[model samples]
Target: EAKASYWRQLAMDEIRRRSEYQPNTRRARNIIFFLGDGMGISTVTAGRIYRGQRRDGSSGEEGCLSWDRFPHVSLHKTYGLDAQTSDSANTATAYLCGVKANVKTIGVDSRIKAGQCHTDKSTHVSSIMAWAQTEGLWTGLVTTTSVTHASPAGTYAHVGHRGWEGYVPNNCMVNDTKDSARQLVEESPGNEFRVILGGGRMNFINNTENDEEGLKGNRRDGRNLIEQWMKSKEGKSNASYIWSKEQLLSVDPSTTNYLLGLLGSTRLPFVMEQDKNCSSYPTLREMTEVAIKILQRGPKGFVLFVEGGLIDYAHHANRAAFALEETVGMDDAVISAMKLVDTKESLILVSADHSHAFTIGGKPERGKDILGIGGYSTDGYPITTLSYANGPGYNETKVNYTDAETTDPNFVQKATFRRYLATHGGEDIATYAIGPWSHLFSGVQDQTYIPYAISYAACFGQFAGSNCHTCKTSTG
Candidate 1:
């Protein structure tokens, strides 16, 4: 009776919160789009429950994430232009450029082939960052993956192949075409970015110059792009290039014009692997805070993209704890970012580029450890709550999970078949939105709708008109 009363009161509170909600129809002055790469609905549910269980000692089912409070929510189709299951490059292109492209292609429409160098120039598509830049709005990008990785590259760089971040493939001999690194540093008006924080330092520096962590640069052309970017910003005030957390925190946003921070040598450290007391990198939440502080300095407002990319890496490895922890890290960043912006002037959208074929089954009692193993199967094998459709976890021989450390950071859940890496799922992914024109996100929409929605809400790109209050006031 007491439990029933508690649940009833919770439901009533949710109802009241919903009843009090009033949609803000104002033009968005800023847009903070958070992409949790490979975070599916199942991943969110498991991460929510796991985080709640670990942080609050609660049952976890009732706990709400920062995005859970978003006023509008919708499911988006994640398939590529040609394939039912999408890759990060295709999905990133879809949502960032508002055009669906073939797998492994970035910042180009469907006509471009994945690795054909000649077609790259003709099929190029402009991203929201380019549109935002044209309208005099400051723009930035942050991610747990390499800054040159598919999702982040989608914002500013165009390439035939996503892997051509620093160097072109061995077989492809296109001397005229520059790599994603060159595009970001030289072609995209790199010095104009208000804030660019994330990983992939090796792609920007030369082979002789080591990264902050003593990691060798991978650029074959021997161009130190970071040095080039710094040279361009020489006359610009408050232009700083940072590689450490201490330097990042010391910068004054009020006095800063451009800030480029590469927080990791490659991809940022996973939340589980990061040694908080000794690590050189900043957490995702810290990076988001610094970015918001810097970008909000512009009088014209800004557009920032934050990606929780480690979630996908963990999922690919079939590491449930790592994936869930990464999601929790992303949630923390989202919560921090939400507090920094006003809903009246900012539109925040949270979604995933794609999903992994992960599942949570073998229903244990409520409040049970989400990472713990479920009861024994009918075949007398203990199964975990988290398992993949196919992965490195597949074993030919039966194994006992009764005493295995399933919750360990390195633990990989059991799988039905063996594969080099767990594959992406084809199901619809959820997109949560709030602030100006968020209502347009209602109902199932194509992934392409996101970039359009952002462009429209901010009154940029093809949607620029009298309805865009910020645009009209700033331009006039």
Candidate 2:
């Protein structure tokens, strides 16, 4: 018994030490921030239980690697300066720049005059990625969404509103035409980020043009950002541009200092839709691995932002099964990242930008079926084991419906939709960090401080307040 106690103490000591472990000042070389877009505690909890049920016969313990394994964990308030239920643009701006800005604004605070309305200017501010790039550190941005989408765009681009895409600009005068979506993706090139990956081919394509097949489809920007990017000095000598999985794996990492990979014209296929012969697409994990390999080649330490950006979309569609699978895929990406970089010298932070209104509540039998049996009852009624609070095509009655039965085709579980009163936990979202200044994240913290916390950890807190003061001791 005494020997067993000694081993347990040793394990506890090791865990505690891991939490407090600081990186060597001289050797520390990289910072990787992984954002799970809408992963709330319940979302993560449901994911764990789902994976556990699939693996072993029982729902695993509350503590799992994604939740329990990080050295330090904290909660974050996700409200934007203007709204309560935040969007990715504002939340991402806060995470990337450390300030609470107006909703739909990217990479800027809400003080600038944007045409008629008082909106933030993307030019006045600097993003962490920009800072890293200025310091000569190689940076990479990867997401399942468009490269210019909110989260990914926050890493580098700055704009008054996130909706600059889709709509045609009202004014076409030379000076007034700058706000057009086409120019937003390419022509405006001050903050040219080294590594760019993801979808949004539509933004780059011209409105009228035909491809080799003579199909008069929208040709990506006549400028051809992909071709220009590939032919540039960075793309030609230091980087390899790949639009498919085959090109991604075949590229020589040692010689490639930069890589431009866009798997799909839109968001990449969800995990369920992807398979081994997914030659045209790359999984989140695969992109992460390749990004790390290339970024590490830089002499200065690098900053890489990877997003499981699709989780939120699944929740929006009320597809819990798809959301859970995406979360698992995110976990796989985290594991792959940890494998390549040593915790001793790297700072790794895993967190969410905001959360979904999803929850897990159903008393399924201990070893019972996942797709429950015996006419499942919540309070007391025939219902499916899974449900959503509020979303499109939602209905409290019928408990089961098909596309033909519902008004919306995007609806996942139409009939099973019992409108439970859903709410985001007033409790801040969870944050996990390892290595260097991870200690800063212990206990509950405001959401806006995350970027500062990361910057401090990566640079040993040296550049804490130079420009990014939103995360300093005052904010905390």
The top-ranked prediction according to TM-score is: 1
Q: List model 1 lDDT by residue over 1-476, tens digit each.
A: 26898889988998998899777767789999999999999999999998899887898977888898888999999998789999999999999998888999889877777886743466788889988888889999899889899999999877888999888875565556777878887776344678889999999877877886789998887799888988988887778899998888898888888888887778988988878688777889989998999899878889999999999999888888999999999999999998999988899999999989999999677887888886778898887888999988888888886535887768888888999899999999999998888888889989999999898889888877655645455434
Best candidate, lDDT-wise?
1
* Superposed model 1: Cα runs more than 4 Å off: 1-5, 170-175, 189-191, 467-476
Give me the runs in candidate 2 sitting further than 4 Å from their true place.
1-28, 55-58, 112-123, 166-168, 172-192, 210-222, 234-236, 276-279, 367-379, 383-385, 400-427, 460-476
Please give, for residues 1-476, the per-residue lDDT of candidate 2 as tens digits: 24898879978998898777664433236888998878888777767766676555565433265535776788888887777877888788888878887777776676732332322243445668766666667788888877767787777656666755433234422233332234333432323455667765555445575322233323333545555555554424665667677777787767876667766666787776667564467888888888888888878788889999888877777766677778888888899999999878788888898887665555655544333322445555544344556765376454543223221323364323443323333336888887667767787767878877777655533363354333444543
Candidate 2 colliding pairs:
204-220, 204-221, 205-219, 205-220, 205-221, 206-219, 238-257, 399-415, 400-415
- Candidate 1 global CA lDDT score: 0.87
Model 2 error, position 249 (Å): 1.2
Give the Å error, residue 168, model 2: 5.6
